[model samples]
Target: MKMTKTPIKVRYQETDQMGVVYHANYLVWFEIGRTAFIESLGFNYHDMEQEGIVSPVIDAHMYFKQPIRYGQDAFVKTWIEEYDGLRTTYGYKIEDGEGNAAVTGSTKHVIVKKESFRPVSLRRVFPDWHQAYSDAYKSEE
Candidate 1:
């Protein structure tokens, strides 16, 4: 399976009064990881949006193992956890540059028509994209 790694330094602005990263910032980092994964496949999401296809998250989940503070660097590892006809799951791991994990999570998404919001199966409508996903497919199940 293919994976994308993104390194980010936690900034003070990303922290709350507690001095740890704000809970909401992890979601943003997840997005950054996902976007990097998408680009790794040689597809541009901005172009996809212009093509009238919108990939929206149907589900997002994360488990926090440790608190990350400002000035610490984290590496987000992202991979396609699974891809079926109409849905795709992306898995992520936020870690200290070493192997210790800070959080493990996944996001489920489906491509939909920008105007109608109806799900579109990439396998049939866009075989090339589906193939791209297949090459990196992963599943814990």
Candidate 2:
């Protein structure tokens, strides 16, 4: 499976008095990774929103493997773990400078109408995007 790695510089504001990154910050990293993944495919979220389509996260999960400290360089690795016609699950891993995973996560999202918040199928609204996601998806096998 191909994963896009986005480099991140840990900032003091993202950490606590203990110098360790706050747990919630990992979610932000996940988002950054997700955006990078989408951009890598030549698509941007702003264009989608302008087109009346938006994807909202329905589920989120994270596993902390190790502590990340302020001033450390980290990388977020992202990939399409699964993609169906209506939903997409993205996998994420945050690695420290030494390439050790500091956190692992996944987020599930569904496409929706930006105005009404009504669920929309990617297959119906964006066939090319759907096909691209399908092609990038990694199956359990």
lDDT string for model 1 (1-141, tens) is: 788899977889999998888888998999999999888888878887887999999999999999888877898999988788699999999987666889889999999999999988888877877888887774231
**Candidate that scores best on TM-score:** 2
TM-score of 1: 0.93
Report backbone clashes per prediction.
Answer: 1, 0
Candidate 1: regions farther than 4 A off: 138-141
Query: For residues 43-125, could you state the per-residue lDDT of candidate 2 as single tens digits?
Result: 88998899998899999999999999998889999998888799899999999999999999999999999899999889988
Q: Model 2: runs farther than 4 Å from truth?
A: 138-141
Candidate 1 lDDT (Cα, 0 to 1): 0.87
- Cα displacement (angstroms), candidate 2, residue 119, comes to 0.7
Question: Model 2 misses residue 73 by how many Å?
Answer: 1.0
Model 2 misses residue 122 by how many Å? 0.6
- Model 2 clashing residue pairs (backbone): none
